[model samples]
Target chain A: MKSFVVARDLLREAASRRWFLALGLGITLMLVVMGLSLRMDVVDGALAATRLFGKSMNTQIRAADVALRPAFVASSYLIFYGGLLFGVVACADFGPSLLAPGRIEHLLSLPVRRFELVVGTFLGVLALALLGALYGAGGLVLIFGVKTGVFSGRLIVSALLASVTFSAIYGAMLTVAIAARSAALSAASGGALVLLGIVAGERERIAEFFDSGISRTIFRGLTLFLPRVSSLARSAGEIAGSEPVDPAALTSMLLGLVVFGLAALSLGIHLFERKDF
Target chain B: MRRVAWLVAFAALLGLSAFLMSRGDKPKKPERVLKAEFPRHPRDWEEERNRKRRTLPPAAPRPGEDEGIQRKRDPLLVALPVEKGKSSVVFEVAALKESPIGQIWLDCMLEEQAENKRRGRGRDDFKERFGIDLLQDVERIAMSSSKVAVLSVAQGAGRFDKSGWPKRTFGEKGAIWEDTEGRSVFATWGDELVLAGVDVKEIEAAIARLESKSPPQAPPIPDWSAYGDIYGVLSPEELADMLPEEQGEIAARIRAAIDRVDLHVDTSEDVAIVADVNGSNMDDVTDLAKSMGAALSLARAGAEDQGDDRLRELLDYATIKPRDGRFTVDVALPLEVLKQMGPCRKRDAAPSSSQ
Candidate 1:
């Protein structure tokens, strides 16, 4: 609807702020480098906690002789950390523009309805995030293919889904920043949401919530309704060989990206339409 | 934007190269290796250096060294590993019924054992009721009676260590302990353990067969006097055969492995070890002994790789057939013989103690 106009404005705003795009891209690049270089094996450090698992009764097994199971198991330990880092940065990058001074007035003056503006901005960021993901992940695949001689379409697809997940959170937070009075508060709010997720991620209660089918469904639904935070890092993990990506989860994430992107776009437009700024 | 895309593609290639290069860490191999290991060496070197290293390690460098240019062969080098009471056993779990593909083997075994029991033909009688062809191998341990006794030892299934640490029990203290099965002893007298389960009727037939076999009558410790030419002898050439370059390589490898250990020296007291198979048949028993040796060798190599020259056991399987599995085909050495090899050597009491 009118949300498409808002999505374009946000993209144009981010494009104009070239440094913001560079910073976000740079941070994600760092995450990719760190993740790609991480050695996942029986070797010591970084992999220590990973090694203390999956018992084999075969005593004759030598550490040097052990084979890694195929899948995203290699980067399992760092997947969450990867998601958390990039999600925070992505959210911060998207939020500032939504709350930038004079932006609401400029958005309102446009001939496009508020809903179309919402849809447009939402689609615009989603497209950009998808493009960024392909760059980051295509590099990962090239290196991983040479090292292991293995290419997994699942990895690329899952990572793409995960990138969208991160974009969802950024989209939602953009809406929040738009609704807020100050850019500083908007960015802080965006950042705080990611931080809170990280801090609360490992709590048993949260773990139980993730473990429960109902909780997963409800939380997933909420993410779709608002904005997502966990998908892109998970997708990155899939590429980095950390977690298996379920088709159902990816579908949910992709669908959530579209839904939340629309919602955030609409919510931002609604807030901007009434604001005098 | 297209340039950005091209740059991203280039970055992808760079990242790919980085990952590929990092995985290529293959260490160089070494040559002419010499690894000496004692059963137990102290981790506390401050205490060991201050105190007398006990057990006069077999390879100790003596103070009053006699480096005679006159070549005399070391008798121990020529001496063959004697049958210090050799024994053997073989345990093969051949599928009685046709095993199905894609099915779990262990589960099939338990199920098969159950089905036979339902038919009142099970291992409850261990031999007769179950016509499973398990065999026995026996040698003349007793001169008077043709009867052969068999023993199998296994670790008791108890929560010994809940931390999931690999706790090895064999050869620890060289003290023989009863398995939870209470069938075999860990180490009865200065050697490894062998286990066998057999049909007694089959064993009787083995005993009759073994009765016709004459026992090799040899001295408890064969006299070394006749072979005195090699006594107390070390040719300079033999000692020099252990070149500095060879030792350096070994030492370097040892040092690399030392990160996993707390050892301070590269001393090992090499001793004669005999490994025997505990089987129902003589061949079975011998094969079991050979396997015991293979398993021990593997363990020794692993411990050596870890840079600890202290957990070697010069053990051989005694050709002593615990039971006659070769006779019955009802049984052989238990398939679980791998468990009997007791993985880690016991702690060292004296650094110089002759192994």
Candidate 2:
């Protein structure tokens, strides 16, 4: 219950700082630009012609969904990676600001436990990420649906997946901030993890580059525990394109990512509990 | 004790994550077994093109020069009269009829023929009128100028009947019949070869050549180039005439630069066409190849800009490669695209009813 209160307070702080307003304004501007510039001539569920900014893009008629598949795929990827980068940059200062010298002493005097504070901050930042993803990805989906009259649910699902993926990233950011008490270090660590996760997704193919030796073995072993973020993004794109995906693999990967996030948060709480402050 | 429990739970979750990560599926290799064989990468396509060019059989040894060389000449090419600059084309009808593409084409043709028969617009049956099954008995067809020669397997089956023809004898064992209007002549040479022409003198001369009553000339198309389902050599003048009238300057340039074009189409799988254009000189060939490559690139870019994927894909596979003082243009159309271009299967029901 105290964690929920702490999370609510963080949301209030975000709202007071105008972070949500900025995100909403940016998304609205994009939606307006798209709505004003794009035109489609549809006949019997086929796109007879399409134009952007008064310039024709396609001449031959094709099934509306088929013609827009590449656009959906590109949007899904942008949401996945762009949302993570936004969360990393926007939510970085929240943790260090919570653990600031004067605020830490004042918060420690409250009814909340040390672990609850860490868990709350993690949940709060994750909520911010979820809201941002929905506004950005959902706005694009709505625009495409209105213009093309082909509503695909996969982009919305991709937005949700991006938030879940960001949870794992934010957990690490919180852990770094708790240890170092520096916002720059937290954001830098998040950026590095995103890069590492991309490498981890392709580690098997990258392994072929190295010769058979201990160095290759160590590289493989070190990356084995990192979340496969790029693979998740690719799966999102594939789903958007209506391609078949293995549900068992997707479920297992999602579970692994969530568990990793919990583990990182637990480590941060452990570090926070022993601090003198 | 509570702090220790936290550490234990963190360790347990991390271990579980590692296990789950390992359980996640590895990327599956693409399944290409049932799909038509198209090169998935440009480099693979380049290698395939190079390999095909490298593996064409060496040119046939000149007669009387390589006495030890034993090569069976294609009788169809041998039957055609050799003219200095005339274009000749030979269709391996039997081989094409056995290929998948040929089967589709034959099915469509037979269906149309059956429809025509039902409408009372043509012969009741091609086999009855010709004394051989038109679809099954024709082995090869060769054409040059106004003359056409057909080779039939029906001779081996003793189905070739000449009983209804006027028996005006040409060369020995050759008979000629004039059409009712006296505008065309049909001649049969031996049991296997039938020749049709607008001129009686040419048909008689061809028959005389077949009988060796005159001196022999080299076959218009060599045996080495006769391997493909459709093979031919086009004269420079014929090539020039094929171009658009608006491109007269280009046509003139092409005629001045090009000597002849050797064309081949392999329809056993996808339609793979190769045309080798011989030039008057190395520099001319190089310039012509550069122009062709530039034209292809411009067309491909236009297709891409217009978002015409079908034309773009076709242009993607079209390439001009220069080697051995000549240039080869290779193009491939996948069977999938061909199936789409063919008659719709929904209309196939009409054919089945006629069948």
Candidate 3:
């Protein structure tokens, strides 16, 4: 209950920021552009054609539901990929601001557990990202649904997956923030982790490029514990693209990513627990 | 309300994933039907079809047509002799002709012919001039480096006239009709088979191998039915020879690491090409795959930097992966890019009875 209160406060604090408002306005502006620009020509309940930005689409032709797949695909990719990128930027300051001299003193004076403060801030940023993904991706689903009368729930699935994926990256960002206490450094670390995680997902394939030697061993060792960002993103994309998902692969990848995120957060909490401030 | 909002948002996300999982297990509905309209302006329709083909997965079948009916289970590939130790290239023509892409190519050809007829430029009857209707008579065709053999239906049999035909006599074998203009010598195997090529001795050797029990050294016909419309096995050297002059060095390096290459091509929906390059050494296969990946990345980056969207799109679909003792390079071709190549139009313009 105390964690929830702290989380609520963190969110309330974030809402008052000018950057948060700008982010909301940016999302609204993009959706408005999409809604205004997208036009489809329906023939006999089938999507015969579409036009984007007054330029007619020449290739795509399919059933109404299937026709809206491109929209979902675009949104899912953005949410999973673009959301992580944006989360790094948007939540970079949340950590440092919480650890600011006055704020840390006040929080430590309270009966709140240090771990609870960490957990609260983590949840708050996660919630913020989830809401942002939903607003951006969900709005796309609704826009296409209203425009074409073909609604897909896959966009929602993508947004959810995006949020789930973000938790892992955000955990690492929080760890970096605790260690460095610099917003720029935290954001850079988060961005680097995202890239490393993506590479780690294809580590086995990448390792094949090196001859069996110390170089190959180093490559394998470096990526052994990293989250499989690309693999998870692929699963989400498949779900959104309406392609069949390999249940075992999807489940295992999701489990691995969640565990990685938890480990990163636990390590951050351990480090924060020993801090002088 | 604030506390409830967070819980509700989390629950909604979990619920959405559940919804996706549930729907995924359900079988998809059959594809929607479409009618085939005979193209009036063949050129324009060809352009339109080519433009639309980039969307992927091959053209959808016409209404009331079962695509499976066209599949041939026991293809004549069993008759192709794969010589060991020597370089060769093989093709599964019948399977290719039955593919969706094959049907589209045939229809385009027929349309082009029909247009020619409207202009009064060619022979009135294909069967009368060529002695066989390509669509109805020919069943399969296979080619090696030196020889070509065709398996045909009975209608195409004995159609080659021997009377007054210029027969070129070789040392021991009797005179065979020499099509000097076509640069081919034609020999019929009873009624349903024909062999033709520049090297008469190689043609005879191919026929001898076919007549004998399947050679112990013969290369296996790759099972590519699940992967693509056309499948083949070729020596690395043969594969390298097919590459453009600019990539000769890469091709040579690739050939050094591999003994045989299995190729599968699907043009039915989207243009996908998969090449499985087998090498004896695992390390060599891994190295080869890396080089190929690097080459492809360089090509993609170059395309992007140069603002060549088509090349970049093509490169974006290329994947190289190494497994066990072999590596595979898969490339997906964009139809719009292929249309720009003018290959189909060039073939349509070739001399034919209709023209």
Model 3 chain B lowest lDDT segment of ten: B33-42
**Predictions ranked by TM-score, top down?**
2, 3, 1
Give the alpha carbon lDDT tens digit for every residue of A1-277 in model 1: 5565566666677667665478567757765764555443322100111221244222211112111223343343233345435545544555555445586457567786554554465576666666655655555555444443445454455556555555555555666666665545645665765655433222323434585688766654333222324333434455444333454544544564445444444556556555555
Per-candidate chain B TM: 0.17, 0.73, 0.62
**Model 2, range B1-355, lDDT digits (tens) per residue?**
7877777877898888867875663764552222233221224543353344232223345555564553333445666778767788877787788877778866766666767788754333545644656556667778885465545445742232443545488767677887667676777776777777788887887776666622357767765565577778888887888877865765787789998888887777878887888987998876666666555655665787899988876765666666667888777776665654564353555567788
Q: Which candidate number maximizes lDDT?
A: 2
The alpha-carbon RMSD over the true interface for every model, in angstroms, is 18.3, 9.7, 17.4
Predicted candidate 3 versus true structure: per-residue lDDT over B58-161, tens digit per residue: 22335675665422222234334556533333343555566555555555666568777787643345455436555566655555553555454453443556
Query: What's the TM-score of candidate 2 when only chain A is evaluated?
Result: 0.95
Report how far off residue B247 is in candidate 1 (Å): 37
> For candidate 2 chain A, which ten residues in a row score worst on lDDT?
A58-67
Q: What share of the true interface contacts does candidate 3 keep?
A: 0.00
Residue B246 lDDT in model 1? 32
Clashing pairs in 3: B57-B269, B58-B268, B58-B269, B58-B270
lDDT of each: 0.36, 0.74, 0.65
Supply the TM-score for candidate 3: 0.50
* Sort by lDDT, top down from the best: 2, 3, 1
What does candidate 3's lDDT look like per residue over A17-131, in tens digits?
A: 8878888999999889989998876543345457889897633323455556666787788788888888888889888998998999999999998878988988888888888
